[model samples]
Target: MTRATASGKQRRATLLGVLGVFTVHALLLVSRAAWAQEVGTVAEVEGTAEIGRGGRWSPASVGTAVQFKDALRTGHPGRVRVVFQDDTVLNIGDDSHLVLDEQVFDPAQGTYRSVIHMIKGRVRALVSEYYKQPHARYHIDTPTAVSGVRGTEFIVSYDAATEVTEVVGITGRVEVTSPLDPTHHGVFVTAQEITSVARGKFATPPTRLSDTIFRQYLKGLEFIGGGHAESLSAASPLLTGSAIPRSDRSAAFEPPAAVAGAAPGGRPNASHDASDLLHQPPGIVRALQNGNGDLGVRF
Candidate 1:
């Protein structure tokens, strides 16, 4: 071929080579995105809560998609509710740091698995029954302990300063074990039971939950909206001390302010309608006082 023709052919070949590389790079990006599956969504957020990915933090709001390995954190008086793809609900309390370590939902094989690592503070979980599949498992790992559940409602609190971990069972059963143990020998905490794991120790034997600790656990997970600091302050008595009067128990059960148009006496108007906003479950106040086992709330 002529020299000019040969040069044109080489240019065409180089262009095709560049285009092929670009196509491959784009496909790799798409594959990476697909591999990072969305494991959950932020159903509600109050005060200062953030999502962390790749070591960077961003403000979290309702409808924010959470992928595997994402970190969730909250500031003082901040609260967040996350609903996983399997309908498992996680309520992160104020001043908490948690990470989604692993989550997989395989409908074809009827399997689901998840691991949430709690670095500090508290979290309440309302695990859906859909996780009852034979091979399904859910775990919440703390610095000292690991809580495993199949289908249950429970609370986990980790204190970074003290290196202590506490697990309280609201309904069903939760197995609390030391994270360092390979055998997974643990204690089963059932409804109305509580267990604690101290630094470098196995979980304490499960025992009946005390009214004082139960109230504190519930308050930690309760939703806080505007002006909630006042409510929380009012419930300070419940957070402290080892015992509280049964009659005074209602003092800690303050409900959040009604939506703008949702007040009982207000003129009927459009407003957000969901139990998540009205965080308190029906008759929860009574349940607290009566010490009943019917304190289940789906949110």
Candidate 2:
């Protein structure tokens, strides 16, 4: 072939190679975009308060969807409340970090499912049945255990020190298991029952609070009477000698105890008193200040 003809053939080959490279790059970009759209994404952050990282704190606003690295800190000394679109509420306690793994909502079917992974901390969830459906699922995973709930209210805590998980049912039933030990997993706990799972072992038997204990639990906030009011009045150096109302007196009294026990899977002898104090009937607020200080309440 002539030199000019040979040069023309080489130029055509280079042009075809360039076109092939561009086509592959375009295909890869399209694939990535499609994959991201199908995956889970944060919907919204209705309300958040006193969120912190490292040691600094800042107030979070609505429409701010939580990212993977945004850690959550409680506003009050006790629990932080989070409300979802389905009216499901999660009350996270102080010094807790909840990582959102996946969340998807289907407007057509009115179905929503969420999965949250707790690295370390405590969370109390009140699952509403308003949007009750079979497909509505809520799952929480810890370092050692996992909990599944269809429509129930429960509390879950992960103890980094002991590598254990504790779960308490407040409204409905919950199924808890150890994903690490599938052979000995699958346990159901009803309302007012507590279940614990250790690091490598399966979940333990459910512990139902005795009626007396439950009754006392129900009256925990009402144990003290008017006499206690006088005691609080006399003890308060700041307040005048005037007697504080029984309701107000009880509100001022602080219990020197750690409510809410250790991780559920911990030894049976573990302090259940702590759990009691933490989950006391509503209207009673217990606060733990400093490192080892006892429970102090503002009633």
Candidate 3:
């Protein structure tokens, strides 16, 4: 071949090699995305809980796989709890609505992100152990406010009637901000503190969570600990005293005695690790008062 023809052939060969590499990389990305799409499974569902996907609604089951962009809702006496691959858990209260906006839980690539939307009602979150990773992110967006947390356990409640959004920090730390005041930055909320966001302005100052109301809410859910009990984030006494393993619990609906004395809505003390969470069966967790759900915890 002529020198000019040889040079052209070499250039074509180089271009083909580059294209082939790009094609392979693209395929790997597609496969990885499919693998990563499943962030967690529906650990528990109680009462009339339903999931909305692609505008269609279906009742959630015990082992249902919860995917990204799925909206979950519950009617009266309904609730749900979902646990991710990394052990991070989410609890949805009765008459509440939440959407899983994003989930990227590939720890190998150091990509850990969780963004959920609280359209209405209540949601409790237990940030994963991987949450402390620099690139990890976890947030719950409400109609009026957005709460960002790090390795924390917190509650977010929204009342559509008054348009009030409440954020209660139980462990770790949380930063709350409202879109109304983008320039206002964020309001840092520590454990045992609570914050609120009304219809218009930015977030309110952090305050101590109300013990009475908090326990009342817990009692109502009656989250059982075993035999279809909800995940750890639902409060089977995530108290300061001991470590409750999920695998050790019996199938009965009763929780350990330590659970009732867990000091409702208290400040975050020393033991904020994942070991503090009580272990329970994965289904229909009702809050156990006095170690049993027969009667609500009245103190």
Best by TM-score: 1
Q: Better model by lDDT, 1 or 2?
A: 1
Model 1, position 79, has a per-residue lDDT of: 88
Listing every candidate in turn, what is its Cα RMSD in Å to the true structure after a full C-alpha superposition?
13.4, 17.0, 11.6
**Candidate with maximal lDDT:** 1
Clashing pairs in 2: 166-264, 196-264, 196-265, 251-299, 259-274, 260-274, 260-275, 261-274, 261-275
**Could you tell me every candidate's TM-score relative to the true structure?**
0.67, 0.53, 0.64
Writing each residue's lDDT as its tens digit, candidate 3 over 234-276 gives 4333322234444442221222223211111222112222222
Clashing pairs in 1: none
Q: Give the total clashing residue pairs for model 2.
A: 9
Indicate the residue-level lDDT of 156 in model 2: 83
Alpha-carbon lDDT of model 3:
0.63
